[model samples]
Target: MADLPNCPICTMPDPLLAADGYECATCGHEWLAAPDDGLDDIRDANGNLLADGDAVSIIKDLKTDGKAGGIKVGTKIKSIRLVPGDHEIEARVDGRQLLIRAAFVKKA
Candidate 1:
């Protein structure tokens, strides 16, 4: 049998490969096959895959509404958290939590 990835939802070792995707034997969960290594679906401005706890730098200046000043280019952010949404990254900048778009950053 071909090497199949474990179930993503249940972490089952034995997942049955189906025509559409994979089905977990233990939890009966179904999910589509991962694209490439599947380390992360998020990518930086340079197309580098971003993982949790990675450091990134802002490529462009971003202005925040109702706040004086803003995030500037080349600002380094460490220990970023990957999130699911329109804003794909979560991090703390200057003691404020910010949700950042992937296109504005590059892996540092």
Candidate 2:
């Protein structure tokens, strides 16, 4: 993060490599340098792909709406895709493909 100091609030070490940047590991601070964090490991703390993701998981107790609700942690998910939204995750669960929020799930 050029010109911008790592978040003072969160004293997390940011290892930027020119083109892209991301949040500090210690703190949930995201750094947006001029471009993307080529490292593209931008998963939630749980490691779930942030929508349009390419993996799946059930490592956390996730709450759902409509007919499906209460997905127990450790529920294995597959074919995850990342999306652009608050809960950024697109995967198939219980045979029903839907968009899941990243914060709610973890990597498998």
Using lDDT, give the best candidate's number.
1
All candidates: TM-score = 0.64, 0.48
lDDT, each prediction: 0.90, 0.61
Angstrom error at residue 65, model 1:
2.5
Best by TM-score: 1
* lDDT agreement of model 2 with the native: 0.61
Q: What are the per-residue Cα lDDT tens digits for candidate 2 across 38-106?
A: 435447665534444355556667667776566787787766776555656667788777776666665
- State the lDDT of candidate 1 residue by residue for 1-108, as single tens digits: 788998888887999888888899999999987755433589999999999999999999999766898899999999999887789899999888999999999999
Worst 10 residues of 2 by lDDT: 33-42
